[model samples]
Target: MPQQSAEALTSQQKTTSRRPAGTLYRGREGMWSWVLHRITGVAIFFFLLVHILDTALVRVSPEAYNAVIESYKTPIMGLGEAALVAAIVFHAFNGLRIILIDFWNAKYQKVMFYVVIGLWVVTMLGFLPRHLYNVFNN
Candidate 1:
């Protein structure tokens, strides 16, 4: 067996160390997009579940349903609703990015991720002001 020279070993280690572990997306935009997608997905799911349960309260007791609905009118709940909308917007746009990756073989995944984020920001910007005004004023 031949022993590698110190310079050869050092150069090899430097190159290999610079390479990230795991997949191409291990710590990049793709990884964050994937993580945010799953998180927002679960958040949306739980929000929907809570919404359904609260709506179902109407069948059990109209007064209880009204009370619950009224409680959601607070500023805190308004902020929470904003977060929900943000999550929904991100999830929806990211879903489209995933579809493009799968069907269109999108090579510019990082670009697509940025596009999704930009779209989400634009959408939220359009929505938040009026919604916040209505929530805080009424």
Candidate 2:
């Protein structure tokens, strides 16, 4: 068997590493939406875990629970809560879009994806005003 020359090995490595990632991610909306969907899902899961633990604190003591809940009423926390609602909205609608693509029809994926985004936007617009009003007014 012949050993490969250093120059030959280096040339092969250059060719192989040229494609760090293929045309798979050419700024397509669908690809980005899928990525965001996964991110929001993971975030929601962690938030739910913390939320459950906080709710269970009522069992420990109602004052502690109220304290924790009250702590979430500040401007920063209100903004955080708004972002949470946005994440929840996006994740929920995207999940339904995914279901339609997987079970109902795959051909209308692009259109459905846009529809999902529109619905998410409408939902956020409807909720954001009320949520901010309550948060700020309280």
Q: Give all TM-scores, in the order shown.
A: 0.84, 0.74
- Highest TM-score scorer: 1
Write out the backbone clash pairs for model 1: none
Model 1 lDDT per residue over 50-83, tens place? 9999999999999999999999989999999999
Which ranges in model 2 have alpha carbons more than 4 Å from their true place? Answer: 1-27
TM-score of 2: 0.74
Error of 1 at 3 (Å): 5.3
User: Which 10-residue window in model 1 sums to the lowest lDDT?
Assistant: 18-27
Candidate RMSDs in order: 3.4, 4.6
Question: Which model scores highest in lDDT?
Answer: 1
The reply for model 1, stretches above 4 Å from the true place, is 1-25
User: lDDT for model 2, on a 0 to 1 scale?
Assistant: 0.87
